[model samples]
Structures are given as structure tokens and as C-alpha cells.
Target: MFGYVIKRHQLWSGKVLLFPLSSSCASGASGVRFVFGRASAAGTERRTAPAESTGQGEAMYRRKMRGMYISKRALRKHFDPHNYPRETYLLCELQWRGSHKFWQHWLRNDDSKDCHAEKYFLEEIFEPRSYNICDMTWYLSWSPCGECCDIIQDFLEEQPNVNINIRVARLYYTDRASNRKGLRELASSPGVTLEIMDAEDYNYCWETFIQPGVYYRFSPENFESAIKRNCSQLDDILQGLHL
Candidate 1:
């Protein structure tokens, strides 16, 4: 039979001492020969080497802990792992239309069609922390103006820290229906705190020329000035209402 035992005073290599017990213990024997294996000091040193190395490793680990900044909460959380991952972002693309629809699509998935539309068309109103608020629409008349205020409120909530910028065509004129919708949207959205600027209008005869009747030419400078004037009037109304 073979058995192993370790003493507290023994070093690392001293843990595996084997003792062999012969089956002749029951016999009434007067003398017994016991062979004792002598271990050299070098062998003893080698046996204890691993323990010494481990102790050194532990010392280094403790030293490293001095530079570590481990919050108690963090330590507890790490030791007891959580199943949930931290949320990192928000996605916004609601209430958009026309070519702006393409930007909505891009926000959802970048490989969408019409990705290269003009920068003036796609304005990104972001928070101070670089979070997206929402896409602003130039063709405001499509939606009723009454709903504009709520939409603007929602936008502000999404990006509370950043300012807003309204993008409009420099010389763009809308039909009666589009204009009505635009006015409604702007009127509804009152809490919209941001800068509004008209985009430099591109003169295309086919679109702007047919305004008066069969053809109507547009003046970019005049359109830009007109929008600014309207916005100023709206601002006054907002102040009057104490909004």
C-alpha cells in the first residue's frame, strides 16, 4: 500500500512524499528493516523552488494592486458578472420626407440609395455631446403645422444639450399645399431652440420657373431674405406667448 502526506513546514516540492507499507505488519517479528531514502540539500532546494517563485509572483501582484483603482462596486460587479450590457446610443429618424427620406434610410442603414445627396439637404441637429436630435424637414408643408411643436419638443428631449439649426432652401418656393404644411409644422414646434439658415438656392428653371404659371423664375437672394423675415415674426409670436 502507498500513501502520501504533507507537513505544514514542508516547502512546495515536499508535498509529494510517498510512504510504502508492506503487508507483513501482522506477523510477530522481533526485528524489522526500514530503508530511509536520504534527500540531498540540492534536491530539497529544487523541491522548494516552485513555492519560492509563486511567492515572488504573489508579491508582484500585490505591488501592482497599489497602482490599480478598483472601485468597491466595480469589484463586486465584476466578481458577480451581470447578464446585461450597457446601452451606448440612440437612433432618431422620425418625421422626414422627400429627399430627406433618403437620410432617414441612411440613418437606419448606410448602404441605402441616394446616399450622396447634397449636404444642404441633410442637416444633422446634434446635442452638445454629439447625439443626434432628429432630421429637420425643408418641405414642411407636407405635415400639418400643428404637429411641429410636439416634434420639436421630442427633438429637444433627444438632444437637450445642443442647439438646433434649421435648414431651408435659399430660393425655394413651395406650392399652396406644401406651404400650408410647412407653416403648420413650424407653428407646432415652438420649443425648437436653434439657428435657422437658408441654403444657397440652386437655380433650376424646370422647378422654380413654373411658379407664376407655366414658368416662374426665382431670385435666391429674395427667397432667403423672405424666410428670415418670417422666422423673425414667428420669434416675436413665441415671445408674446411667453414660450
Candidate 2:
């Protein structure tokens, strides 16, 4: 869930950014290093004399830059494992929205079907046979827990990977409001640190913690952006992350 578009500089320097994938370690030092594989042809320089250069042999220096230097947000599409095996994940809020019938139809479809995208994504992104997927309706506070927590806890208990991710489906307008309640619950939990974002005070957040490199899945216009904008100071724990 913490996946992000890393800053352009780190992308250029070929440094693997680290992020806290597990709740237990989320509050501690950089959780783990998810290294970005380096670009080829590092430091290979070439120089050409200026066309206007006098008898003096003045050369302009240039280095061959290997690897596509796309923007941070675009990295996921450019380097997706399905598309590019040696790929890393980017930030996204995956919501599960359809009914059982929808999933039933999905389960019956082949890879070529449009509905198959969700199933394929789950298979590739989620730990195999580890978590139970479910859908729950939204409410004022902790509404998802009574019905959904079991499936979630079951998945967490089964998956041993420290680098775990939570995915949701079927995002709606009300979903944003639900997010606030859910995040509050998570933050109030024993070890969770809730980073609430208020839309009106967004600029304060951006200047506070979000480091230069990290970018959230929420668009610039989304309420979450305001929160990130104000909490930019949290960048102290975010820059140059690997996991």
C-alpha cells in the first residue's frame, strides 16, 4: 500500500528506495531495501569538439545514459513484471468492489477476458494461497471489521512475506470518507501510525514530510494529496527506500 513514484534524481542515481511493508516495522528505521536495478553503461563518457572550436581542441563531455529514464509515476507501467520481469511495484489503491456474482463470472473467464485483469493481477501481486479475498460495504466507523477482518487477518496470518501489500477494489466517492475511518482505526491500533490528510490544509502537509522522490497513488486533486503535502516532513523516514 505504500508504493510510490520515486523522485527523478534517485531514479537517475540507480538507488533502491526502502519502505516499511509490514505494520510491525512501519514505525522503525527504513523497513527494507527494494533495490532498483542499476542502468547499464554507467560512467561511459564521450566528448566531441565544438564545431566553432578554434585550433584549440576544446571538447564537450557527454556520457551515454542507458535505461529508460521515465517519470517516477510511469515506472510501474514501463517496468511491470508481466511486461518486464525484473520490475518493481508502484503505488496504487486497489479496491475490491464487485459482488459475488461478478467474481464468479470472473473466476470462470479465461485470460483473454476483460474481467480477467483483476484475477491475473491478484495472482501475480498477492501471495499464492495465502490470503482470503472478500468485499465489505462502508459505514461510519469500523464497519468493515465485523465482516471483513476475518478474511484480512486470515491472509496476514498465512502469508509469511514481510513485504505484504493490501489491495482494495471498486473505489467510489464515499470510499474516501471510509478511508478516514479505516485509517483512524489502523492508527489507533497498537503499532499503527495514522497519517490523516485534510484537503483544505494540503499545502502545509506537502511542505512538511513527503520527500522529493516519493509520490502517492492519489492524484494531485485528491484529498490525500493535501495530506501528503502537509506531512512532507515524514520524508525523513521515506527517502532512498529499497523495500
Which candidate number has the best TM-score? 1
lDDT of candidate 2 at residue 239, scale 0 to 100:
34
- Per-residue alpha-carbon lDDT of candidate 2 for residues 1-243, written as tens digits (9 for 90 to 100): 122221212111344333322322111111111222221111111212222212211111111121222233333232221232222222221112111111101111122232222222233223232222322111111112222333333433443221222221111122344433433333233311223223422332232213446665533244344335324522321231211
Worst lDDT 10-window in candidate 2: 99-108
TM-score of each: 0.25, 0.23
Quote the positional error of residue 80 for candidate 1 in Å.
63
lDDT digits (tens) for residues 73-138 of candidate 1:
321221111112121111111221111111111111112232111120122221122222222222
Give lDDT per model, in order.
0.25, 0.24
Off by over 4 Å in 1: 1-144, 158-163, 168-218, 241-243
